[model samples]
Structures are given as C-alpha cells and as structure tokens.
Target: MRRSRAALMAVVLATTASGTAAVTADAAPASATRATACPTGWGSLAEARAAATTVPVRDVGTGRHACFDRLVVHVPGASAASLGHRVRYVDRLRQDGSGRTIAVGGGAVLEIRVAAPGYRPETGAPTYPGRAGRPLPGVDLTGYSAFRNTRYAGSFEGETQFGLGVRARLPFRVLVLDGRVVVDVAHSWGAAR
Candidate 1:
C-alpha cells in the first residue's frame, strides 16, 4: 500500500492508493499518526474514548483499500465524543426510528450506531438525509470484493444507525477522526495459523 498525506480543514488524510487506504487528518500530527491494527484474524469488538461534540452528520462516503473497505460518515461539527460508535454483527438490521427489518445482500450484517445527531437541531432537519430502507445508495460498490452495500437504518434520539453488508462476517474496526467517523471491514477472515 502506497501512503500519502494531505491536510483537510484541521485534519490530515493519509491515503494509500492501488492497495489503497483511507486517511483523515486533524490538528495533532501525532494523533493522526495513530494506527489501528485491522489485519486479518483480529477481533471485531472495539471501544475507545469518545470524542466530545454534538455535530450532526452531513455526508457519507466510502473507499476501497488494500486491506479493507471503508465507510466514512462526515459530521461537520463533530468532536470525538460525537463520533463514538457501537458496531456489532447482528442477525438483521432494524430502522432506527421505525424498527423495521432491513434486508442487505451479504452473509453478515455489521450494525453501526454512532453517538451523534444526523439532523439540524432547531428544525430537526435530516443532516444525512436518506431513504427509509436504504439511505445514501450512491455509495456504490461496483467492483469491491468484500463490501456488498452500505445501508442507512435511521437516526433517532441523538444517535444515527447504519449497516454494512459484507461478503461474509469478518473482522472490522471503527475510528473517530476529527469530524468523521470511519468503519473499516477486512477483506478476508484469514486462515488458521
């Protein structure tokens, strides 16, 4: 994987192309350099000190990298606390507001719940507006080997819900960088050592 660095607002995004990787840059150079070991055979569960902010989610983006597939949720006013997430493999995805079962193509579903808002505070307008069953379907995986689909369940209370469809149940990681929350799912489960 080829690594390159760039500055985004107060963040720095170090990206690797070809066997690519997604990166985000913020104020602290050392913080940006902190790495998450997402190689095959790693554990799926993770928790970290949630950054503090109440920023609303505005955009959702994705990337294909050498080791994993990435999903990035952009929250303009987000701090570390606001981007905290709970990710786990679930039997099925249920809409946040509606509690309806969502169908996605893959052997497993990783339910992502971010501890942030996805709407305007005063008016309650949706920040990351998406369809009920499938939000932000524009993030296409035409040639991706691991990722099948990214579905938005909903945003209720102060949290936003999302689901990632993978070829199989695999190791995944979540990170909060600057104004974004990221999810990286490995391409393979790895063979026995």
Candidate 2:
C-alpha cells in the first residue's frame, strides 16, 4: 500500500510539471524579445518620455525649468516614514558623466551596483537610437554599495531628476532635462520581485 501511494504521488508531481511546461510553451509565442537600438540622443523630450515606457535608455536635454514644478525622484525605498533615515542614496554632483563629486543635495554616494552579499558594479548597456520596437536591456544595480547611503548615479545630461543614477537590476529609462532626472522603471530582469 505504501509503495503504491508513493508511486501515485510521483505521477501527480510529474503531471503538474508537464502541465506548467505546456502552459509556458503556449504563452511563449505571444511576444518576442525585440532588441532596442536607441540613438546617442533622442530628438525631443516628448519622444524620450514615450521611449521610457518601452525600454532602457540614457539621454540629456535643456529647457526652462517648469515654472511651478521642480522635478525630484527620491531614493528607492525611501518614504515619508523613513525621512532622514540612512537609506542608500544617490544625487547629482558636478557635471554629467564627469566622475566629479560634489554635494548637490542631501544624500550619500552610490558605490556598489547591487545590494546583495556579493555584488559588483556593472556598466550601462549599449544603446542605439532610431531603432523602433526593440527592447532596452535593464540596468542591474541590486547589490551595489553606496557611499554614505548615496545610491544615486550621475545625471544623464545635467538634468536634475534626483535619485536618477546608475542602478542595479532595475530596468529603467532615463530622461534628463535642465536639472531633473526622469527615471522610468521596467520590470527587473535579475532582481527579486
């Protein structure tokens, strides 16, 4: 009787696995992984915004700071409840991509890429423009270490979108204008959900 029960259980498990595999196979054909080729610079801000929803990106722009709004993106995982708390942080310092460090605001510097036990900083993926319907590879910064809770990467092109810096494992599209960093997050490809 015991042997029969064990055999039945094994059959049930195998059937479940096969069912899952079949479902996955059926869903696979709905969409394909299209690669994105974003150009060095996007044509306009509106176009950039539209692109953000679709894939990974990095861009810069200049314009009149919106009269009534100063765009700001807070550190990930930050909240009103955690104000003044030492959360890994990132901010704009010096010029864009200059590697210069200056305190533009109150935050720490980003050091590590991902925030796991053994993680290292990674580079931004290759980008191309004028290639429509392609997918942008997401940035992976999950285990990255920050200097003094500063996890913000540098600005895209001197834009002031705070907390818009190099991130790990977070799929994002960046739009930099004036003094703001607009970050659009895609689904993370290599981080815990």
Candidate 3:
C-alpha cells in the first residue's frame, strides 16, 4: 500500500531520465495553474569528478504539465560520473565547442551546459550521435504550449551545451536526479496570465 523511498527515487529517476519532467509529489498543486516558483541562478558544477564526460546518449522530450512545461536531458549514467552541469537563461547562445552563434527561436534561451566530453577518449568519435547533426534532432514538441525549440549547440573540451527556446524567460527549475538531468520552464510567470 506504500512505496519505499528507494522505489520512489527510482521512479523519479526513470521518469526524468526518460525526458519526462513530471511534476513531483512535493510540487505545488496542479490546480493552482500558475507557473510553479522556480528560482533562477540554480546552476552548479559537479563536485566529485575532476572533469566532465560526454558519454551520455542524450534524448530530448517535453511535457505540458499542469503548472509548467518540461525539457529533459536523459543522460544515462551517474550524475557525478556523467558531467558537471550548469543551467542558466541566457541572452544569446554560442556553441561551447565552436564559439559560433546559433539561431534559436524563442524570446529567451535556457542554456544547459554539462562539463562532459562529447567524444570517446581514444577513438575521438562523438559520445552522442551529434557529430553529424549538431542538434541531435529527434524530439518532437509539436503542440507544446511553452517550449519553442531545442538546439544541440555543440560539445567540446569536456563540456556539452544545449539551448532551450521558450516562449519567454519564465521561472525554471533544474534537477540532477540519479541518471537524469531535468529542466522545467514555467508556462506563465504567474496565475494572472
């Protein structure tokens, strides 16, 4: 009749790792309708690994939950072992690997950077299938309410970056749970909208 903490955690891990950033049990009531409160400046670098790795089969997905729209990066590995991550809403985007500017469609850009090498150590091949397609185009956000688009900016020097095009720079939250990294953008700044 009850779920164990470990099982619950595993469920959360699987959901987020599958690129489904569902509103957790502790999240504000869905009926509230207003965008959930996501304090900005929630960026942090992994503390365990001396460096980052790009050995993740990155997948993208979005879901329009009751309170927010979610963008998830399903990295299948240890959070500490995968990559040191940093998330922020930026004015513009330049690929971390190339320094070239990118044209993303959105009023605001949420840059998700992980300090991981996007390539194997010896072979020099990319860790993900992004060498040919920069954006790793697979996810479909066709009728989503908030997410505009996503771009695989680039990965370089033990780091990878992606840009999230949102309707605007609204409140957002990032989570590193087990093997998943999540980014959820609020649909509205408040209930007034």
Candidate 4:
C-alpha cells in the first residue's frame, strides 16, 4: 500500500510540472505582442528617447502617473523636423487580480488611411487575454475623445500625421500581477492620409 501511494504521488507531481511548462510556453509571446512601429528614420525606442527633450507630465489618474518626451530632428538645409512624441504612463493597482500595462507610440506614423469619425474600420481590434497573439487592433483607438476625436489606428496610410506635429502618441494602462507584465490597456492617436 505504501508503494502504491508513492507511485500516485509521483504521477501527481509529473502532471503538475507538465501543466506549469505548458503555461510558460503560452506566455512567451505576450510582451513582444504589444510593440508599435517606430518612425521611418528611428530604429528603436531608446534611440528616439535619446534625441527627445523631456517634457512635463499630464493627466494623472488614480494609481497612475504620466510623463512626456519630445525630440526635434534637424532637417537638411531647413528647419529641424519634429520627429514624434512619446507619453509614458503607469498605473499600479493594489486590489486582487491587479496588473500593469505599457503604451508606446510613434505618433501619426501608424494612422489608418481612410477613417472618419463615427465610421467603423474594416478590421476589428485584436484581443489577447494574456496569450500568444499579435498586437491589439489599432481600431480600438476609435471614439476615445482623443487628441482631435479622430481614428488613430486603422486602414489609413498617408502622412499619418496628427497632434501638434509628427510626434506619435502612445498611451498605455498596464497591470502588474505579482511583479510581471500582464494585461495591457493601450491607446494611440493618428490622422488620415
């Protein structure tokens, strides 16, 4: 009877280990899934931040704080080009099932080509409940009383310029669960082509 009990315990341990492994495999892609396309000239977020001059924060909410950054690029034989802007905001909830999200934007560079207010996009937003998937649909950006009440993400594809200049705005509400990045609430603003 003791030997039989030991065998049963070993089986339970093996099953639990396998379940944990499966969950980790499923989570490998969530972080990479939430990235936006940087401007044409800039390669990465760090590079863009290096060129940007720090600005003041706006719109702080409960458990949330916001900060802004601006970068002015010197154009050839002309006025310096304002590449884009970034807003970094974070919210930490202390309640049960709490989490954190991050939002980064390349500004109007990713605007949908032919979107008008009150018009839905051809594609729907991507939904990822902490699983392997692509970035959430930019279409979710519709109807948020945004910078100009415009459709920031969709099929639009031209200058993609919005806001004060070329700077893209990326707003995110992240949830931190037990010190890990999970459940992201991200928003962006862009103009039509």
Candidate 5:
C-alpha cells in the first residue's frame, strides 16, 4: 500500500508540472508584451510654463519619427530652464500683437507661444525670418505623418507665436531642452507599436 501511494503522488506531481509548463509555453512573456505596448502617458492637453528670457528664437524646424512628428524651436544661448512656453490647441491661430487670424492647413491647429522674441531685443534684427500671416520659413511639411502645415503668427512684446497644423488632435508632449523647445505629436491614439 505504501508503494502504491508513493507512485500515485509522483504521477500527480508530474502531471501538474507538465500542465504548468504547457500554460507557460502558450502565453507570451511579460517583457515581450510590454515591448509592443505604446506609450500613452502624454495627453492632448495644453502645456504651459512662464519663464521670461532675453534669448531670441533662432529658427523653427521639423522632423519625422516612427511614432511621432517633432517640432523644434531653436533658441540660441538660452538654457532649458530659462525659456517659457504656452502650447495649446486653438480654433484659429492669431497674431501676437494684431490678433489677426492666421490660416493653417490641417484637421487641427496648435498654437505655440514662446516667451522670447523672434528678433534681437537691442537691434530689432530678425532672428527668425518668419513673418505674420505667412508660412513659416524653412519648414516644409512634405511627407510627414502628423504635421501638415506651419504658419507664423508674429512675435511681439517679448513673445513669439506660431501655428502648427496636424492631421488630427492626437496625443502630444512638450520638452524644454538646452537651446530647444521641442513638441512631439503622436501619429495615432492607438498603439504605436
């Protein structure tokens, strides 16, 4: 009877072990599942900060990425902590001083306001060559996933404004890097991977 009981216990243990192994084989690993997951922490909301600086905006540029499109505002001689910005979705983009409506092309419009002028403070020399109610100079939206158009909304009173047209009102994030104010717009609301 002792031998028979021992044999039965061994069989039960083997069966249980094999069942667990089978279940583990059928399921994906936790890291693999996480690798395919998209980052959605950034939401489609306004992001703002209020740092005043004398550094001028040098240029505006754009780039394409796998998951998102990037808009970079270059500020020469400015640290990330010294720059201020107010970025938000708006029905229409308006000029900084005149409040004139600026036309942008896309399903959605993002208004970007940086607390630094586009011109030199002392000489009033244009640092960024973008003009009011005109397409942003040197920014071409060709073959981009999220960006459609860019418009200059003028710079006045120690602030520069811009209008960005995107495919949709998707998730976005803002970052202040050394000499740059970066805006990243995601391609979709769904999984990026």
Candidate 6:
C-alpha cells in the first residue's frame, strides 16, 4: 500500500510538469496573444446625453493603446458629474451652428460633443481656439492604428464639437472622468482572452 501511494504521487507530479511545459511551448508572443484578447464588450452605439455644464473645454488630445485608440476632451475645473457628452458615429461631420460639412480622413467618423463652451464663461474669451473645417492644431494622428484624422467641428452656444475619423465603425466607450471626457475605440471586436 505504501509503495502504491508513492507511485501515484510521482505520476501526478510528472503529469503536471509535462502539462506546464506543453503550454509554455505552445504559447504565442505577448502582443500576438493580446491582439486576439481584445475587449469587445463596448458596443458600437451612440452614447447620448442632453445635460449641459458651464465648464469650458480647454483642450483635446488623443493616444494609442495596445487594443484601442483614445480621445480625451479636457474640461478644466469640472467634475465627472458636472459634465455631459454625446458620442456617435456620423455619416459626415458638420460644424456646430453653421450646418457646414467638415472633411475627415478615416473610413468612419465619430462625432463628439461636449456640453460645455470653448469660451471663458466670465470674459467670453476663447479657451479652445479650434476652428471649423480645419485639423486641430498640434494634433497629429499620423501613425495611430485606429485614428486617421481629428477635426474641430465648432463651438456654438454652450457646446464644443470634434470629429474623430477612425479605421471603421468599431466598438467604443465613453468615460467622464474628473476634468475630462475619455472616448476609447477598440482596435477590433474580438473577445478578450
């Protein structure tokens, strides 16, 4: 009985070691594995909001992640609960209050509207000097995997607008963080591993 128990333990250990080795040998590189493990939970749909705020938009920026591209709208002195936004896929980007179409470079355009003006509330001075039908100053999406262009639609009344041109109408999500509104567009609609 003692000899049989010892043999069983030895076999179990051996099997576990071999299994681990096999998995290690068959594993893909980290980046390749992560490409297939991209998150797909963020659906491709219009995220709408009607609420407004007094905080003015300060800046707009973009970044690239491993699985997604990010667009951030900076609204200084504003809390997440104090800001409102609307993000949706659009056939063509149009300027706010002008009804003029703005040309974007990507296969699809994501329209972003923040419920805040681009002007200082106290003095009405322009906080974000972005103009309609022009590429945003200092923003270059040259090598980004998902983003092709970034254009300023306009700022009218109490809202600021932007047009994000992407590779396709991909899954996306919006996050209203403190002092900012973040939009993430996934590289693909694959299931995360």
Candidate 2 regions off by >4 Å?
1-99, 102-169, 174-182, 190-193
What does candidate 6 score on TM? 0.80
Which residue segments of model 1 deviate by more than 4 Å?
1-13, 16-41, 46-52, 191-193
lDDT of 1: 0.69
Looking at candidate 4, the ten consecutive residues that score lowest on lDDT are: 57-66
- Candidate 1: give its CA RMSD in angstroms: 7.8
* All models, RMSD in angstroms: 7.8, 19.8, 6.0, 20.6, 15.5, 12.2
Deviation in Å, model 3, residue 164 alpha carbon: 0.9
Candidate 5 residue lDDT tens string, 74-159: 89789989999999999999886677888999999999999998999999998998888889898878878889999988889999
Poorest 10 consecutive residues of model 2 by lDDT?
62-71
Answer with 2 or 3, whichever has the higher lDDT. 3
Q: Assess every candidate by TM-score.
A: 0.75, 0.19, 0.69, 0.15, 0.80, 0.80
lDDT for each residue of candidate 2 in 1-193, tens digit (9 for 90 to 100): 4664465456446533322111122222222353222223211122222112112223221111101001123223322222221112343333235555544222222221211101111443332221111111232233322101122333242122223232232333343332223333322332222
Among these predictions, the greatest lDDT belongs to 5
Instruction: State in Å the error of residue 149, model 5.
Output: 0.4
lDDT of 1 by residue, 11-93 (tens): 22344221124432232233335543346555666444444346788778887654578888777666655567788888899
How many residue-pair clashes does candidate 6 contain? 0
User: Model 4: runs farther than 4 Å from truth?
Assistant: 1-105, 108-167, 183-185, 188-193
lDDT of each: 0.69, 0.26, 0.63, 0.22, 0.80, 0.78
Off by over 4 Å in 3: 1-51, 80-82, 131-135, 191-193
lDDT of 6 by residue, 1-193 (tens): 4664465456446533322111121232344433334666798899976677888998887765546777888887888788899999999998878799999988899999999998987888999978788898777777677888999988888989999999999899998877888888887777653
Error of 6 at 98 (Å): 1.3
TM-score of 2: 0.19
